[model samples]
Target chain A: MRALPLIPLLLGGWLALPAHAADPADARIATLFNRLAQAEREQDFQGTFVYERNGIFSTHRIWHRVQDGKVIERLLQLDGLPQEVLRVDGKTQCVSGTLVAGVGNTPDSSGRLLDPLKLMSWYDIKTVGETRVAGREVDIVSLKPRDQHRYAFELHLDKDTGLPLKSLLINDKGQLLERFQFTGLNTQAVPTEQELKPSDNCKAVAQVPPQAAEALASWRSDWVPPGFELVKSYVRKDPQTKATVSSLMYDDGLARFSVFLESLDGESVTDTRAQLGPTVAVSRHLTTPKGDMMVTVVGEIPIGTAERIALSMRAQDVQTKQ
Target chain B: MSREALQESLSAVMDNEADELELRRVLSAVDDSETRATWSRYQVARAAMHKELLLPQLDIAAAVSAALADEAAPVKASRGPWRSLGRLAVAASVTVAVLAGVRLYNQDEISGVQLAAQQSAQQGVAVPQVQGPAVLAGYSESSEQATGPMANGVLQGQAGWDNQRLPGYLRQHAQEAALKGTESALPYARAASLENR
Candidate 1:
């Protein structure tokens, strides 16, 4: 009798092992990421959240509403400063005075949605467990980085809405580099138009297309960490310095970094590396045939990785016409 | 000095109007946790008004004090540059160095020490080829503080060539992040933080 029972148990165990060995776990994780990416854009809700890194902590109130197929979002800082930003249809309509000033004129580049297939290649996404955040139940999902170049993220996403209520950026040693978590959430009702209106202090921004410079296309990064891809590149002249700064931005779907190359114009500047909260800025001098250019890399990455990215930056020599 | 007087001195310091006596007074009490908290609050209020970027919790005085404490043994006996400055001047210099370090670049060349500022970012760097450009001049890294100004979590405008250019770079990086940011309000917060005085 015991043998008969053992036979079924063995069969059950054997059946489950292969099924688990396949892509079901990966498929589930991908589905969760897809839902999470879609939720923030499609959903209409309001909440209060806090962002913290190192010794700095700031609280904010966010009201995201979608009406008539247009998404309007308003964010206001709760402490320290009354900073505010209002975006309509994924483009910034106005911003609190002095925050972005003249920089807001550039055409907005719509963000890349979280691609599960690409993300799977760099991160091992798994359903860790369940937890409660902001008075709502959430499923804990871990995006463990497969390499050392990036940090791991443990996201507590709301079960019903699939919105990330709590997210933590953790280093390999388990040190928390930065955290973004909601303290309160309300998904029941959409925010009103009046609530989304820019404050009196908010100034409308003008969008100016960057002047076309052919030199930007000639510059390229000789090396970048695996899984990272160049997302956007452009050249813009500095209003203050009057030097054309060529910028290249790269992203690994989740992590992003920007590289800026500006000619010194005979002004000597030493190489520098500084870390601000979770963001690291590294400036290195690279001598190109055009001139001595200052290459700076800024992003939310480890200092070593950033420095490597800085050193790996190389200018492509222009081919002479026959 | 009385507690109220010390508070007034702290305020005066934040406003950049404090005399020598008031500066010394605030430095003495800066060790106390309450005093530090009050200092942070004042910084926050001032930063908010100026629309300046600030890391409210960064205790520059405390980091200086820790740096001083670590150097206690050798300071009393040696006639080194630090010893020549005297105790009072050393304390004052600590304040000035930490504050000014954020906004100024070294005119004189300082060898870039790759490992010096690697305080917390020393993990997972497998490639030895990418050690550092060199120890940069004016790049102060006390035992308690990381890469001085940058690690302070705030951007203060320093009237220098590099200082002027740095803000543009920081803003461009931040604004680009915000524009391309589909993740959440994190990028937006980062962009906003850059605007403070």
Candidate 2:
């Protein structure tokens, strides 16, 4: 009888020990993500990094400063066509290179804050290991997708400041799609105002009045990958084609894709799909009562998911009645 | 063996007309650095005659011979389904290696070759529909083309509807993502990379 009581105690201790060990690991991962998010908002650092994908590679120097609760950042390409972009408090102030016409017309939405708690549902975040990056000891955190809808990410965050020093996007087949790594960093020296100023060549972004809310309400997606939510919706008029394009942006905390719906106006265009490095674009044709519409999905997502999203779009009015 | 006889055997093997004895002679002498140099010189001369790109450093024959040598030993008594399966596995791995080698070789030339192949393909020169190695090679080539034209890191679409709108659409998506700024410099870097093209 005494031996039986001891057996139950031993079993209970074994189970409880695993549960205790797991909870702290989970909490530590969450804490690291939380620190990373806060570091972007509060920390002031400047560094030079190289970004590479299958076909393209470029080096850039970035100067980011936080003052009086506002973030000012400037990015300049070091080699080839000195492209520069300046943003104040996460809003684009100006850009040196040519952007698509009418891109800046949409009303600027405030930047989406990274929510680690929300991201946990879509990605299994874990501290896979540790390594050194840019002469700093770092922790390698892996964000593996729970589904095939998105790609996986390996992030190397600085141990002291929780700043990401290197990031890699890997596809399902374990092939690396893109890489962003900092070659040098300086966290102690704050970037001066002169360094953060935009060059004379930088042209200011043109702003237009926000379109009516109902403009975006005309279309809806019947199905989307789980955990994704509509983050922004807007309609803009194309200058050259004179077509009004409605765009809806969706995000699952980390991964994001945009669905664009434009009336074809009887133009006979074939369906097409293209992949640019880590980004995929799929265009599909849909026949409706009004006319033909071209639905395009573009983002850092799998081509299969983009195609599914393109096919899932429906006229909102028809959807609501059902 | 005399160097002259070995050279003749090497030439015969290169021409794929080697008899069994000549093939064995070349295989045995492949380990000698002098013989290997002679074989490489023969390959370079042959490639030059055919106007083919010469990867002179690639010693595929030696590598394959080494692999076969490693796999040559087996318990003769242990003959059954497992042995056949092992052979099948080896064949599959060899196929995979060839596929990977072809892919790496075609990366730079793919865009141009694909464009010509597409044009000829549309002209009714139907692509061969054979099984085995040819099918695998053809499938990979076509699939690479289907991803669209990426020449010198610049996304250049065939002139048509896609050419008109795809670049614009790409830029808009990238700019939008940069504006979102949720992931800090990543989206911006992606957008800037597009401009470099």
Interface RMSD of each: 6.2, 8.1
lDDT per residue for candidate 1 within A223-245, as digits (tens), equals 67667887677777766567878
List of clashing residue pairs for candidate 2: none
Q: Measured by TM-score, how close is model 2 to the native structure?
A: 0.71
Please provide TM-scores, in order, for all candidate models, with all chains considered together. Answer: 0.66, 0.71
lDDT of 1: 0.70
Per-candidate interface DockQ score: 0.13, 0.21
CA lDDT, every model vs. true structure: 0.70, 0.74
lDDT of 1 by residue, B1-197 (tens): 68899899999998899999999999889778888888888888888888995677676777887898888465444567556667766565455444334333442222222232332233334222122222222444345245333444433222345455665677778877876665678788776665543
Model 1, residue B53: C-alpha shift (Å): 50
Number of clashes recorded per candidate: 12, 0
Clashes of 2: 0
